[model samples]
Target: MARLRTLFTALTLSSLTHAYIAPISTPSTHIANNDDDDNSDTPLPLIIWHGLGDNYAADGLASVASLAETVNPGTLTYIIRLDDTASGDRSATFFGNITLQIEQVCEELAAHPILSTAPAVDALGFSQGGQLLRGYIERCNFPPVRSLVTFGSQHNGISEFQSCSATDWLCKGAQGILRSNTWSSFVQSRLVPAQYFRDPTQMEAYLEHSNFLADINNERVLKNQTYKKNLEKLERFVMYTFEDDTTVIPKETGWFSEVNGTEVTLLRDRAIYKEDWLGLRTLDEKGALKFEVTGGGHMTLDGELLAKVFSENYGVYGRPFDGQKETDYPREKEL
Candidate 1:
């Protein structure tokens, strides 16, 4: 368990180290919206949300944007940024409130000329960014989302807070607050990670104190029908989990499974799905909800896997993202 938690922390903290060291040799110079007359030939605009400890300026993110451009030409790739500068954006990922961050993103996305004018946009979320986009979709989907794809996201919330380095005061400070008083309103509102800390042993506390996940999941007493209604509007929803993901404790969370000791409750069997609180049941029935897996530790993605994802779920003209996309993969089942 200790080793697993350490690995999870690495995914958050050390992943940044990798990004910082390996620089973008030739950064993408193209503007987000380069199309002269957007038409059926052009693919739907793709917006990406970077994970924890990461910003839009990272080389990996640039590579992803470049790859999407290559795989599907005339693709407009937008990487969401909370702050103007890369350093500030990275800092915001650790300490600032996520609810406010999502709100800022909502406004920016809505005000953009290209995104606002377009019919709909597809989303690609990494780690924490995945859930943030979900929150955005559920709370305020101004333009609506055509397709949603997430990699290594904590959709069901995380059991453990990330460990931080000694020198990094911001991450260490957030860790202290999370570990010290996770259920406190102060921590829940201030610390970004605290909002999604769902403990199996503390069900009542989590439902009572969890501001983001519980509200979005409709786990609270008074359910918001709009969240469910808005989510059901998606053309396709895909979630990918790492095959050997030690970084995310209880990896089944990506599939919306509840983990308790040796027992695992798959999403289909859970009341969350059966009840269709978030409208996942609607998606599943229509053959839109896809569950996929990739080989790696945590966010270890290769070109081939990325190409496959982009090709199937995104690009090239009309229709709601080529529903089902691939026939080789079977329907989602217990892991």
Candidate 2:
């Protein structure tokens, strides 16, 4: 009896693994036929941008694609795979240039006839991919994307410390560094997030002149002029930040909050706070944005949770592509 039970368990596990590993349907070949006359345009195809050090074959991309499939079955889904190699060395993925990644993404989108001609499409970006997409939207003159949903993306830039915590040694050390202008300047320019960290006093001039974050966020040249306008064009903007994400350092950077019309690092002390800058704050003000904070690590939403977020926030499940108002979908209460 024990042997039989073990065999059954093994079979179940094998079946689950096979299900997860199943090849995703080709988006170009399996286009859905919308028969409903109420809807004018077909549902926009979904393009998924994988996280750093990941590819199309990554399990996380598969899971996200699966979740997208569940939301809009038979709809075409494209996975944007990035080449993480620098020169001939594959191990140089961490040093991969952001501008090149954006160019690659633009090239992929332009190569797709369906995506190029369509008015808008939906995008789901994970981790660094999300930040990359934000840059793409800001800089690229290609087709506009209506909805962009990010999972565990560092919008402001990643930090190595959370708020000043008395109990946490790491947080205390980080606080010490941040409080000192000399030490902060030395370390800040070294980190990726520091490039996009808009200081309250220093303003746009504070950003690293050469970093991708500064360029896309319009800090380097135009500075705040075109940044807000470009972000407000999206119909739906959703961001998910994990509660226990140590990878993004101070997780609030992922949340995108600001005080007195300027971005703020700490959310602890604030009166009027805006949750996002990547058009999400404006979308939220206009009832087009949804920001969710779940209990997990970085980019850890499973297929089920992902589906729930998409359905509840964006209403992609039964939503028609055109003719319906954005207000028709069930809107979540403000954060």
Candidate 3:
């Protein structure tokens, strides 16, 4: 009986050892390979600029980064955080000078090691961030950007409030406040005023001073070839907006509209046919400019939609664990 008990004890110990060793070996192999792969594979880097009054660590920015990662596991997203204090005591970021913001972006790109490499990096900008990026690319010209994707951006300045309804009391009140000569003059006095909401007629005077949209659009400095060349370098210039985007009214501004007419659903009608003031028509002619109109509202985008856009325009695709060749994901019609 003692001999039998000893044999059973030895078998129990052997079983325990095997169980422990088996699990350990699998994880160890996986960890080593994962570490090696992470070190060897350089991820495709992308810079993200958040909307007004948002920070680099904002939840929306995180969601965008996660969505990008889902589509391409190799994406490395960097969010550019601006100085929130620049707007004075109000701490309003939109009120902050866009030229200074562009400078910050340039500084960040110039400093990043991976972003400074040969193949140009991509960028995703939202709202005011989008306009800021446009300004940056047109002016800075260093640190090449391969593609730019903007959401609800006011590229040509938002003029929706200019046409406020006479019947709608709320709209009238808001427009009255913004259009007041005193208020407009006060905004003009500010370091970097919100150019989008400014009246087109008064834009010339603001442009002469410190208006960001005016300077970047080359409204006064049209003779600068470098600005045009810099804009032409972008491989893809994609803009997104919805039919009911009230914030960026006259949504054509998002695509750099040459003429302001009735709203159109199709991309062809919305696009600028002639070489307008913004020079984006050249990009359109090269097939680099793309406009995506969705049924959703402002700042609305999901992983599926983002994946489709990236795959169609940027050649980004999914990578399955089975080690198969990555293919372009089919575009969804519902977006």
Best by lDDT: 1
Clashes of each: 0, 1, 1
| lDDT for each candidate structure | 0.76, 0.53, 0.55
Q: lDDT tens digits, residues 73-180, model 3?
A: 567777776654423212334344566667777887888787776366678787667887877788884567778888777776766443444565544554454455
Tens digit of per-residue lDDT, candidate 1, span 1-335: 34433433443565454223132222244333223244347887999998778888888889888778876677899999999999888867765677789899999999999988888898999887888999999999876788899988889988876555668766665456456678887667756667887879999999988878888889988989999999999878899887777667777778787888778787888999899999998988787888888766677776667776777787743544445533333333423
Candidate 3 residues lying further than 4 Å off, grouped into runs, are: 1-43, 84-92, 161-177, 181-186, 189-193, 201-210, 258-278, 315-335
Residues 1-335, model 2: lDDT tens digits = 34422332332222122112233333433333334443443456787766544556655567667666656555577877555432222111233456665687788788788889876777777775677777777766366767788877776554332343456554454345443431244333333333444434454445544356656654344455455666688776777777776666445555554423334433223321243434444565576566567776665555456655555433233353333223322221221
2 or 3, which is superior by lDDT? 3
Q: Model 1 lDDT vs. the true structure?
A: 0.76
Question: How are the candidates ranked when ordered by lDDT, highest leading?
Answer: 1, 3, 2
Q: Which regions of candidate 2 deviate over 4 angstroms?
A: 1-41, 84-93, 161-210, 224-226, 258-281, 312-335
Instruction: Give the lDDT of residue 164 in candidate 3.
Output: 41
Q: Each candidate: RMSD to true structure?
A: 6.1, 11.7, 19.3
Q: What is the TM-score of each candidate against the true structure?
A: 0.84, 0.63, 0.68
